[model samples]
Structure formats: C-alpha cells, structure tokens
Target: MELRQMRYFVGVAEELHFGRAAERLYISTPTLSQQIKQLEREVGTTLLIRHSRGVELTPAGQVFLARARETIQAAGLALKDTRRAAGLDEPVLRLGLLNGVPGWLPAALEQLAADRYPSSTVTLAAGTTVDQVRMLSSGEIDLGLVRTPLTLPVATTSEHLADEELGVLLAATHPLAERTELTLDDLAGLELIWIQRAAAPEFYDDALKRLGDQIRLSDISMSHSQLHSALRVRRGAISLGSCRAATPDVVWRPITGRPLVAKYAAIWRTDSHNPVLRSMTVSPGLTAVRQQVVAD
Candidate 1:
C-alpha cells in the first residue's frame, strides 16, 4: 500500500528471518513484523510462513518482492531524470542554419567542437532568417545562423558571424556567363528569378533597389534548388546567391564594386543558458559582436 511497506516486505522476503531483516533495515524486530503484517492484511494474502528453522516465503510473497525491487529502481531513475532536466546535466545545443550559409560557418562550428564544449552535441536545422527568428522566439532552437537586416522578436538577440559577397547565378550558356565579373548594367533587361520577399524581406528589398527597374524581376518565388533548376533550364534568367554556393551547372560571378553583401549573424534567445552557445558567440572565426540592429 505504501513505499515504506514495500521496502519492509522486500527486506523480510530477501532475508527470510524477522531478526535479520530488522537488523538490515536498522529497525526493531517487533516494528518490522508489525508492518509486514499490516502489508499482508492490506494485500489480503499470506506473504510469509514461519517455520521452527528460519522462515520461507509464500508464492504470493515472491511475486510481490520482484515488483517491489523494480519499483524502487524505477523511483531512483525518475529522480535522476528530473535532476538532468533541471540543467543539472550536459546540455544539447539546437542550432538552426539558413539556406546558403557560407562555407566557413561549418568550419567555425568544427572549431567550436574541438576548442570548447567537446562534450556538447550540436544539431543543425535548415531555415530562413524569418523561420530562424520564429523558432528562437518559440524556444524550438537554441541558436541560428541567419541573414541580417530583419525584424527579430523582442526576446531574441543576434551577433555577426560572417559576411559574403553576393554573386549572380546564370546559365552556363548565357552570354554574360563568359565574363569573369558582372555589373548591374550587364544584367539589365534580363529576367530575374527572385526568392519570396517574406523569406528575407530586407535582403530582397535591397536587391530590388540595387538592380533598379531596368531588370525584369519575376514574381514567382523559388527555393535554392528550384532556382538552380530554373537557371539551368531557362534562358536569359539569373538569380542571386552566395558566391560559395555550389552550382557546377551555372556560373557564379561576383558583382562589380561589391554593391551587395550578404551578412550573417548568430541569433538566439536572450534567456538561453546553454554554455556552449556562450562560447560559440565569441569564437574568433565567427567574429562575435555585441547584439545590435544590423544596418543594410
């Protein structure tokens, strides 16, 4: 009926002698015998048979003893789990990655794993800047590598990770693809494949402003893979992406004068207590900076 009763019964069942069980439990023999009788009455079964030699357990007592041992072990495990959940154990770092992350970002993460927090594990999820911000606000992820120039939730903070030059993705057969570098003037009058503004409004708007009205911007939105397919199949169409993006089927040429740069930052909730995140936010290759609004 009670945990104490189960423990008392288990001690008697294992020792098979009232005096020995009482000694093991550090209790008087009379008290132990009384509690065992109370437990037997509650269960409505005879647990032990007294013999002139020592003692022996009834069949019912053997079954109850097995269950009692299991219950004690389970209780101990439950306590351990509760303590670990309360931040008393090693922490898992959930990291979010936006599409088109610079190649150096992974290297930075590897360095973090080697130089610090070797015991912590990192998980990577793919998302856009907007998606990362929402995940961070909801506590779904601990950290995010996201693009700059966007509105973040009130409780979220961000740090600069790296900056990459924007490059144009054009078909291999396109005339401009032959050039080592491209300018907005060269891309003029060409149809552009654009990602949805909702994905990264600030970056999309900035690209629109720099490209000007001369370029015929398409309204359809496409992801990285879809945009790659469109560039390969469509003619006189181009899209913008990181220069580090691997597109063997297309030419990735840098823009002249570096008019556009894609900035990346590590976004996280201000309340996050993951020690690994603290170490990563200040790592050398990541170029950590104070939490601030990134300017376009």
Candidate 2:
C-alpha cells in the first residue's frame, strides 16, 4: 500500500527474481519478501509466485505494476513542481569515473550532463569499481560509470553502458601474432598481463566465469606501460585489452569465436530522479553514446 512497497514490488516484477530485485533496490531479500507479502495481503490477491528459478507475476500483479509505475511517475512530477515553486536551486552533479574507463564514455556522459544540468556545477572523480561503489553507497557521488557485477547500494541501481572487447596483445614476432584471430588454445605458454586484483575484485570475478580453465591464469601486477615494454622486448609476453592503435612492433588480434569483454554500467541512486540521468538514460543520447563507443 505504501509507495516504497510499490517500488519494491515493481523492482521485483521487472527483474522476476527476488534476490536480484533486492540487490537493485538495496534491500535485504527477506525485507523484500515481507513487503511483497504484506502488499499481497492488502490487495487480497497473489502478486508474485515464487519458483526455484525465480518468481513470476500473476494477472493481478500485472495490473498493479502498471498503476504503480504511473503513481511513481506522478509523485516525482509533483515533487519537482513543489521544489520549483519553492525556488530551490539544482544540486551539484557529482560523477564518478571508473579506473581505465573508456575515454569516450565519460566524455559523452559529461557533455550530456552539462547540457541538461547547466545551472549545476559538475565534478568528476576517478577510481576503481570498488572505490566507486563505496562512494555511491555513501552518497559521495550521484552517478558513476562502473564495472558490472557490482552489488550496488540499497538506494542505487545500474544500467549497462557498454563493454570493451579484450583481445590478445603480443609482439609482432610471436608465433601467433600473424593470425587474424586467436583462440584459447593459442594462449598457452604465453604470460598474461593482469592488473592488481585488489583494484576491481568484482569485475575480475565476473570475468572468471568466461575465461575457461584451459589457460594458465597468472597473478601479476602489470601496468600498461610495463606490458607494452615486455611485449616489445620479450617474444612470449602477451596481455588482454583493447587492441586499438598497436605499436609498429606489436600487434592485436581478436579472440576467435567469442571475445573477452570488460562490461560497464551507469550506477545512480534510484530515488534521485536526477535530470541529467533522466536525459541520457531515456533520451536518444544513450544510443548515441553506445554508437560513439563502437566507432572509437
């Protein structure tokens, strides 16, 4: 019956999973379940049916979802109108950029934010995914370009932005360097350059799902410059990253069949209704940003 309950229900309904919805809403799974049960009792009908895989909405739940969304939208508009009548100034925009974020994504988002929030000053912070998640939870930043698989704060949610395709980077003289595309089998006996795991633990964990056990996974602290230096001087040294603009003595090749990807997302507090977040997330600019990233 409460707005919070409606929002919780909507999150669950959209995701069709209690645990995921709980994560997105920044609430415990038990709390979410209790709220939904209370909501169902008030409505005198079952809203969601739990299953082993996840949950599914009933006929009444579907109808309730439509009204709940409308109510939430109207409530947001009423709040905005009241704030405008009171002559409150726009809040400053605090944005966090993940470490090693693709340059073009931040550039496009920053430009869109400037256009939408001209009266509000914009600030940018750079940090790893772990750091950005902490900042988001503490309300230090209003929005962030962060890696996926992050357990966002209770008040926050995330939308996937794009992924960076990671390929093999090797010296031109390496045995596999001449191939247009390489597979996992081609990676044997070569050293892989990797960032420190402490920097982005969740991202590394998510990436582990795709990287099969066939290749030898090494733990090493290698910077981009160090990797480049090693690739130039050592024939067997290699790394996984964006292959754009390789040096004359170095080459990049795609992973055959499937690619290794570094996923990204835009994290923001769900209740903020931030105008700049609204502008890019719902407007055509989101697609434009994706296209720009692809073009780059």
Candidate 3:
C-alpha cells in the first residue's frame, strides 16, 4: 500500500525473521511487525506464516515481495535520472551552426569551452539556418548559430553574435582582383554570380536589386566550384561571401558605398529547461565590439 510498507515487507521476506529484519532496517520489531500487518490487511492476503523455528513467506507474500523490490529499484533509478537532468550530473550541450562557418570558430569554441566547463560536453550540428531553427524549436538542440536575415521567424531569444561584411571572391587573374576595393558602380553590368536561394532569400534578393539592375545567377547549388569557375574567365564576375570564405587563393575585396552585410547570431528557446543552453548567452570570452572589429 505504501513504500515504507513495501520496504518493510521486503526486509522481512529477505531475513525471514522479524527480529533480524527490524535490526537490519534500523526499526523496532513491534513497529516493523505492525507495518507488515497493515500491509497484509490492505492487500487482503496474509504475507507471512509464523512457525516455532523461524518465519517463512506465504505464496501471496513471495509474489508481492518480488514486485515490491522491482518497484523500489525502478523508482530509485528514476529519481537519479531526474536529478541528473536538473544539472546535478554532467550535462551535454547541443550546439547547431549554419553551413559555411569559419574553420576557426569551432576551434575557438572548443578551446574556450574546454578551459571553462571541463566537465560538460559539446555536440555540434552543422546545417542551414532553416534546419537549425527547426531543430531548436523542436527541442532537438540547446543552442543554434544562424545566419542573419533569418528565413523563419522563431519565438526564441536571439542575439547578434557577429557580423561579417559581404566580400567579392575572385580568381587571381580577374580584373577586379587588382583593385583595392569595389563599389556598386564597379559591379554594374557584370555577369555576377551569387547564392541563388538561401534561408534568407529576401535579404539577398533585395540587396542585389539595389546593388545592380543587371545581375546574373548560376544554376549551381551550394558548391565552391561554381563560383570559382564563374570568376575564372569573366572579367567582372563575382560571388558574395563572408570574409572567412576569402582564402589565400581568392582575393577578398569588400564592397564599398553599399549597405550590404551578412550577420550571424546565436538563438535559444526561452522555455527550455537546459541550463547549458542558458550558458551560451553569458559571455564565453567573446564580445560584440570584438566581433565588429573582426568583421571590419
């Protein structure tokens, strides 16, 4: 009927003697016997048979004892798991990132996390902003790093983590690569290549509309080769990407006299019970001013 009653029953069933069982359980023999009697009455079945030599379990008592022991063990395990989820034990931090992240970002995060939270584990998921947001909304992940001009509107707390000015990537011999910087007029009348469809379609399309009236798109998916080949032959061809994408092989020329910029932010669900999710908002050795300076 009650957990205390079940425990007493099990102790008695194991010891087979009221005196020994009471001593093992640190209770008085009379109290233990009274609780066992209460349990038998609640069950409407006699649990123990008292003989002159020693006590023995009845048929009903044996079956009930097995079930009671099982229930007690299961309850204990459940309590342990609940407490661990409450951050009493080591917790895992699930982090999601959009595609085309800098190669250095993960390294930076790992170094910082290792030095700070040595006991916690971090799992990384890389995908599109749309995919990351969907996973975050569904409670699949704790934190997400998404590109700005978000495709989907999320009901979560989002902060601008960093910004990288859009740069034009060109081959070594391209005519525009010789220039220190480019402007809207420099990109005019050029066979421009860019990300055709992304999570933030409106932002890309609207920015392109203002940059030049004559913009051309390629039928290439998210591939580096398409942009590389496009810039190989065409004199004015260019592809837009963050400064991180600007490698040594390709020249990274920032677009001047333009209001174009790509921003990235960290988002997390406000209702999540994960404490590791909340830690991401707290400064992990990063600052908004430093991010701006790097983007510059």
Best by lDDT: 2
Report the C-alpha lDDT of model 2 over 1-296, residue by residue, as the tens digit: 78999999999999999999999999999999999999999999998989999999999999999999888867865776588578763656678977777777888777777776666566788787878887777556778888777777687777777887888888888888879999877786567766666767777766655666666565566644467776676667777667763788888888876678888888887776556666656656566667666776
lDDT of 1 by residue, 1-296 (tens): 88888999888888889999999999999999899999999999998998876678899988888899888766755764577678685556778878767655754664565466777887777788788887777556778877777777887777676667788888888898889998888888888996888888887897788768878887677977678888876867988887655466787888886467887877777776667776666645245332212221
Candidate 3, TM-score vs. the true structure?
Answer: 0.59
Pitting candidate 1 against candidate 2, the one with the higher TM-score is: 1
TM-scores for all predictions: 0.65, 0.61, 0.59
Candidate 3 lDDT, 1-296, residue by residue in tens: 88888999999999999999999999999999999999999999898998776699999989998999888866755765688777674556777866776655555555445555676788887776777787787556677777666655556877665656777787767777889898877776666676546655655666676677755665543443356566665545678876666656678888887757767776778776665544544673435323644664
Candidate 1: give its CA RMSD in angstroms.
18.5
Q: CA lDDT, every prediction?
A: 0.77, 0.77, 0.71
List the candidate 3 regions with Cα displacement exceeding 4 Å: 1-90, 106-116, 151-154, 219-226, 233-236, 282-296
Error of 3 at 106 (Å): 4.1
